[model samples]
Target chain A: MNAILSDYFLPCLWASLASAGFGLIFNIHGRGLTICAFGAGLGWLVYLLALDAWGQDIFAAFLAAIVCGFYSEIMARLRRCPVTGYLLVALLPLVPGAGVYYAMQYCVQGENERFLTTLLHTFGMAAALSVGAMLVTSVLRALLPKFHRAIH
Target chain B: MNDDKLLALGAELGRRLMSSGAEIYRVEESVIRLLRAYGAEPQVFAVPSCLFISLSAPDEPAVMRMCRIPAHGTDIELLEQCNCLCRELCRNPIPVEEAFEQVTHLEDRCRKHNPAVVLFGYWMTTAFFALFFGGTLPDCLSAGLCGLAVGLCALFGTRITGSNIFFRTTVHAALVSAFAFLLLRAGVAQNLEAVTIGSLMVLVPGVALTNAMREIMAGDIFSGLNRTAEVILVATAIALGTALPLILGQYI
Candidate 1:
């Protein structure tokens, strides 16, 4: 556990700080960074948790969608550029491009079940990330009126 | 003063931009305009930043950006004059990041990247492949990763190359596709995860999303489209490049 924590823990923290710093340097400010960092860290941590609990690659594509939701809403208020940047970067880890590719590979190889699973996961992750981003943006907008002007 | 230092400083400024929650587009344009004033267009690969205006030559054929006094703090009017200089620069045809003191404007933004953010992407791709097609790929059919890696490399290459974005995206995907295929023939399975992540990292519509939201809020679809289309194309190239080898395997 120490080894695992050592390996994952520091990096996750750095990811938070670095991504936070990136947000700050980019002109993101106030509770906006706080919110963005929380979401970014949550995404990183949730993935770590999923990795540990399930081992390797189980339900990650789907859960990553959840993180994207959180990331988009929080970043939308703070960064204020548009939905694409945060939505894309936030969903970076979850994009199922390879999943779709492998599904095709499996289809060619005659594995129907495997192909379907891969296909479902890819679409599921994509849908989830996009919708999640939209949904989160709406929620953050509605709930957090304070960050409105900050929205670029 | 060194070009490398300015570049590094530019990167750090990018990190600060990220941290500040500033519109990376606004910051990048501001920086680009300022650098162009001094006659240097920075070639920094700021995806988060590039999500706004593209890293392309302006239609005006002149550079644009503002600059303030170095040692003395700048007043708002000085900024206006700097903006004036940037307007003129944008009107002239000068190389972007090399026309002036590149780092002086936005030297506060760069920071380290999370390797996990990098690794997770590649790992996600690799695992997705294995989960579905592990049996088909011999004991170690790592070549799929090479294909993905080249896809990403192409995206990064597009940014710095002085070509039009569509051309840059296509060239990047094509070059990386060829590289991935060659690596496979050589039996060298370089971390397909890293390559795919790095290259794809370049094309992700980060700027589009940012600009899309900003434009819509400001009620400017025309400006947003200018940003969005490039992002979508880059993504298309990535998807096509990554899938090419997998698709071709059927015919071969």
Candidate 2:
């Protein structure tokens, strides 16, 4: 239990704080900032859980991104605002910043093989993240009107 | 209805939406909806850099307007306000003049964070991201310092960084990597990777990558390709920028 808390919960907290800070830079205010930060925490939590289950970082990112997309879409519908800000801010934690760094390090050290591997892994991570989030967005866009009609 | 003013208003609002970092479809859809609400059938096209709108009504001359949007940063508050105003206008038809004034002055009403607060935001982001990436407390502090430098450059170094987005991102990434190296050498930071990655988070093109994918999926293949190219350029610039510092550090 303690290990889970330290490993998963702590990182989620950090991700939330980081996202909130990024929200400020993006000029998000008040409740919108909170939503973005919360979404970030939620997405990171899901990512961690999925990582533990599958042991595939890209697949975990894809799962986490789908959750974030749903959260952003629901929040946008409630607030009648664009989903771009929330989605963009929340996904910051999962973006492959470290991959870019490692790739650069390897290239600088003249390790072509590792550089190519890291580069491909980074691209795969990005593609998975995009595909996951966009899948939710596209499906929701098609079905949301029916859902709204049903609710009414 | 004065067709000239109505068309101008539509074009202006669409330009504002584009400049505020709205997606391509949103800008086009919003303008078309707004014009239709005012009894005009409008056609709108928007890319990342420019917007085109052409409308023809029965009695008035066909007017087409094109506006080139300036380089912009994300301002979510402005975007929200613009979207809300557009929706309100569509719900209740308003005088084009009054609506135009409101759309132009939208930025005046929304509160803006002061520079100090934004700098603090930069510090907090890098610090927390360092911790999230498994850095120690000291490493987090150093990363925060590097973040501060990056924020300063982003906010006030436009003259030095210039207008080229690629050059600006490269400069920011290089600054972060160099700062991380110096801090590591000075014994202020233990985890070079943690500090550097945390600082580089601010420069990553995650937004563009996501936006590109969204545009393609939404059927704006042109805009999607444009943003994808931007993502690739920025990624290459980052790799080059960070590599410079590492290569130089080897000699020192």
Please list, in the order the candidates appear, how each scores on TM-score for chain B only: 0.37, 0.98
DockQ per model, Cα: 0.11, 0.71
Root-mean-square deviation per candidate: 12.8, 1.8
The window of 10 residues in a row where model 1 chain A has the poorest summed lDDT is: A20-29
Q: What does candidate 2's lDDT look like per residue over A1-152, in tens digits?
A: 99989998899999999999999999999999999999999999999999989999999999999999999989988887889899999899999989988998898789999999999999999998899899998898677767632321
Q: Give residue B51's error in model 1 in angstroms.
A: 17
Best by lDDT: 2
Query: Over the stretch B1-252, how does candidate 1's per-residue lDDT look in tens digits?
Result: 234433333343334343333333544555565444444456432333232212224453432222221111112122222333344445663443443443244332223224443433333333233322221232123433533453355334445654555556555555545554555556664444433433343344443444444544443455456446654565555556555664574476
lDDT of 1 by residue, A2-104 (tens): 9866556654553454344334323333554555455555666777777778865446544755566766655554443344334434444444555544664
| Candidate 2 per-residue lDDT over residues B31-130, each given as its tens digit | 9989999998888888899998888878767888889998888889988888889888988888888998998898897889999999999999999999
